[model samples]
Target: MIFVTIGSIFPFDRMIRAMDDWASAEGRGEEVFAQIGDGSFEPRHMRWVRRLDRGAYAEAMASSRLIVAHAGVGSVVTAGELGKPIVVMPRRAALGEHTSDHQVETVSWLRGKPGLVVADGEADLPECIAAAAAAANAGARLATTADTGLIERLRHFIHG
Candidate 1:
């Protein structure tokens, strides 16, 4: 199963639509479930919801074979902790998908990280998904070292 998420703060119809189209065309027999935020593009090829509750979100992530998500820190962190194969497609501000290009910066920093495939745009998504699927089949797991460091930093920042 491929679990797709775009977080909850913003609508990311571009990513959702791309994934839906890719899944329909690829016919790889993988089930896709998406948490699409408040996006307007309705997925035709995969199961999707506008938003998921915390428990449902956790359950989806835990059960997913691969995670296709926007390059949000929260999503990345959750995927990292779950040790899932993740393909990140950053939302572009120029396309009105985000408020800024922070997701682009995030993906740049995270590209080549273990268990991650960064898709620069919709065109790269299918290839990245294929890569993620291959990695998952090969038993690849993301190292949580970076996540641990991030947690520590957050803890200090919050508690200090």
Candidate 2:
């Protein structure tokens, strides 16, 4: 299954709509499940709920083959910790999805990371999702912890 989540703090109607459309168009509606948050746009092609409890969310993530989510730190980090493949679409400030374009910055830094795919826009989601799924099938997986070099750099920077 493809698990689509937009986090809990904001309503991401645009992401939800794009996923729903993709599911319908690809005829993979039955394989997609979304935790849509408070989005007003109801998904017609795939199964969805407005919110998921922590346990349910964990279970969904554990069971899914590919995760689709907004570019939030928690989702991305959790996907990494679980060694799951994820496709991220940052919420845009100009589109009223966020207060700033920080998510875009996050995506830029994470673009080439293992097991992560960055979708530049809704138009790129289908291809991004497909690529992530294919990578997962080929045994590509994210790290479960921060790299030792990164941790050492942070320690040095903080101590100095």
| Candidate that scores best on TM-score | 2
Regions of model 1 farther than 4 Å from truth: 147-160
**Could you tell me the lDDT of residue 108 within candidate 1?**
88
Report the C-alpha lDDT of model 1 over 103-143, residue by residue, as the tens digit: 99998899888799999989899999889889878877778
* lDDT for 96 (candidate 2): 96
lDDT of 2 by residue, 1-160 (tens): 8899999998999999999999899845458999998878999999999999999999999888889999999999889888899999999999999999999999999998879999999999989988998888888887777789999999999998
Worst 10 residues of 1 by lDDT: 139-148
lDDT of 1 at 46: 95
Query: How many angstroms is residue 92 displaced in model 2 relative to the true structure, after the best TM-score fit?
Result: 0.5
Shift of residue 57 alpha carbon in model 1, Å: 0.2
Q: If scored against the real structure, what TM-score would every candidate get? A: 0.88, 0.93
